[model samples]
Target: MILWSARWKSRIGASTIRGMTESSTQKDYLFKTIGVIGVGLLGGSIAAAARQRNLVETILGAGRNPSRMRAAQQSGLLDRGTTNIAETAAQSDLVIVCTPVNHIVQFIQTVAKNSRAGTIITDVGSTKQQICEQLKGTLPAEVTFVASHPLAGSEKSGYEFSDQNLFQDRPCVITPDESVPAEAVSRVRQFWEALGMHVLQTTPVKHDLILAETSHLPHVVASALAATLATENFRYTSTGFRDTTRIAGGDPTLWIEILLSNRDAIVTSLEKYTQSLQQFKEAILNNDEKQLRQLLEDGKKKHDTLNSAP
Candidate 1:
């Protein structure tokens, strides 16, 4: 939701570079206040990390339930709490929409309407293309939207399970379109990096496709695997069975939004996966030991490469 300025092109070349390589410890107190729209795992953890790193003067929590906001404020996770989106955005220098993908667009529209000039807007949404598309030009000239997805979270949800260290050593992707100012993108990247994340940037389309393969597909597979098992077999399950399907335990409501949002990309990944499964099925039925061994080895090598990465 950014209106482009001619001057930002002068420094556009440096935006991605600074995002990837900047090591400035001078990032303290970059914002006077940051408002987190949801008080769930990612949102609460962001509040915790910003506090621990001394990155802001104040932290605010905005959500639906008044009782939860009171609890978060009482727990010291937020300096203030409010159910009013405008009230939070009006006071925040930076507003992060941490709601699920389905609600992010509407929340952002509210934020853009109420945010003061020069306020920076961002999100922890896992999917970005739709958000970017829906809110493309709907902003005040000074309010900026830099879509971000922190590639960090747990099957578990809620504030109590949120750890400040959750983003440590994790990857965060910021998707800023051509109309966004380079300076805005750099600021959002700095926000994530200050929290111990490795930052990257790309088109929202590419981000969705990549995450479809690495994250969404896996969750679907895990849930499907878990569903295939019988209730009577639960007592006989071992670590391998449990480990393979642990992501199935994630809240079904949240996962539903994620799955449908990126269903196109996820379907592509699933087609490739089903082909692999078919190959394995044929190999097993034909008793082709060599073919089965080669498929297993191929999977192992790919996994080994991932584990070997620094």
Candidate 2:
């Protein structure tokens, strides 16, 4: 088992580690204080999960809305809530920027400015290439920024809908460039692992491309499908329709930002998706039962492979 060195032990503090005996099954309390910026669904869920798992001693929340933050604090989603991002960053061992994709880089810049040396910073933004590029050379050498996207959450929003198990058994992709310190990457990986996430490492560019196909494209398709349904069709909706369009009900503002941030990759995925749709239309137009069956079988096999994969 890996042990904390004297330097880390000193940094972690004796009080925080008090009564924490080293054991194989012991959960790692990786952060003494965790600062979560934007205490909305994803941010609130992270704070709640960390508290439930005892992964952090304290969770400081920073957001634009005071009333929302106050409600979150009262609901036990945060230990304290503030509008000052820098102040929260200053006190936190790790700062997680959970704001919208557009605001994440600015939040990280604020955090980097106020945070001391050796602080590890990360973001939960859906797109990474832009964020990683914007953050490059903006932070002090002593600070580390690791971009992460947790493949979790639901169509639900707000702190009220947040759950402690939001990220349980979920895949979290960590995008760490060569500029990031090796130790910082390990710490962030362990932190996510403590939250019960299966940490996957990849480059920021690759992550953006993959998420465009897997996440952004799906949301776009769902929204389009839902939009195509007439208002009168709601009464005739079945489980299949509702299931396919569930994500269409997500916050439009958030999805707009995500799509725009990764527009290039999303557009590429959309082109491919449209091509497939065109092929399907052609098969139907020609009354080609064999081609249609083959297409359906191929899709089913691909989905089955995904479902059966570890």
Candidate 3:
């Protein structure tokens, strides 16, 4: 079982109480040391944000590349760096796996095997269902694994482009199943809150489905839009064109893993999107002004609502 400090109990009663206390408290270094596996953009940003906010006394980084690890250390993003996953997992109070989605389960298993009892583990994988399902009964009983996905990051990749404020005011979804301890859930939620994220709770399946439409679909659309524009057409492009295709610049390898991991949901979303496009095209071909106007108006209203939402 995980043990919480008296301060944690005194501060954590209701969600409202937790928020009030966290905002009022001077220091909230819940973890003594945090181990971040795969210290690239997402991982490096987490380390930088934690250090900037004084959320952890030490941030230990581990990656597959020794040179990248050394560079992360030299960049002031890590107190210590290594290529050994188990060693770092064993030493830290909390371990956050930031590796690619395909490798998340392997890292989680390694962490569980090496980490001490009561250590908390989490990941930043974009999709959750597969990881959560694979880890169902695999982790040590005493070790807590909370699946998390932060809705932040730009089209950019690598630690060089990472920002300490990357997660500030951004949404982070935590998908904890019934098997996870309540205390563990609370700790993970508080950890993300400390990093300046708006925490939301949902199930792994729901997270993947929702993100498939809202995130993955957009990336696909953006890439498709960019692909149609010839290099010679660059001079004709405007801000609207640039804005619509910005995410197309995201790392193709990373996106391929994400798309493949959530293939079912993404494909469903794509089918629906394709139907909508067909409807729009048909309206244009028929010169149905009313239908085109109504479609455009509906889109405008939905976009406006999203912009106005908190």
Decide which is better by lDDT, 1 or 2.
1
lDDT per residue (tens digit) for residues 1-310 in model 3: 0221221222223323534565634445699889999988899789878876767867899998898788666656677889999999999999999998899999999999999999999999999999999988887787899999999888888876667799999999999989888999999999999999999999999999999999999999999999999999999999999999999999999999999999999999999999999989999999999999988998999999989988
Kindly give the stretch of ten consecutive residues in candidate 1 with the minimal lDDT sum: 1-10
Please give each candidate's TM-score. Answer: 0.90, 0.90, 0.90
lDDT of 2: 0.86
Model 3 Cα displacement at 310 (Å)?
Answer: 3.1
Q: How far is candidate 2 from the true structure (C-alpha RMSD, Å)?
A: 7.0
Candidate 2 regions exceeding 4 Å error are: 1-28
Clashes of each: 0, 0, 0
Q: How well is each residue in 1-310 modelled by candidate 2, as lDDT tens digits? A: 0121221233234425544656513545688889999888899888878876768777899998888777666555677888888889999999999988899999899899999888999999999999999888878887889889999878988766777788988899999989788989999999888888999999999999999999999999999999999998789989999999999998999999999999999999999999999989999999999999988998999999999987
**Model 3 CA deviation exceeding 4 Å by range:** 1-28
lDDT of 3: 0.87
lDDT per residue as tens, model 1, 58-161? 78999999998887776677778679889999999999999988999999999999999999999998898998998887777879999999999998888766
- Determine the backbone clash count of candidate 2: 0
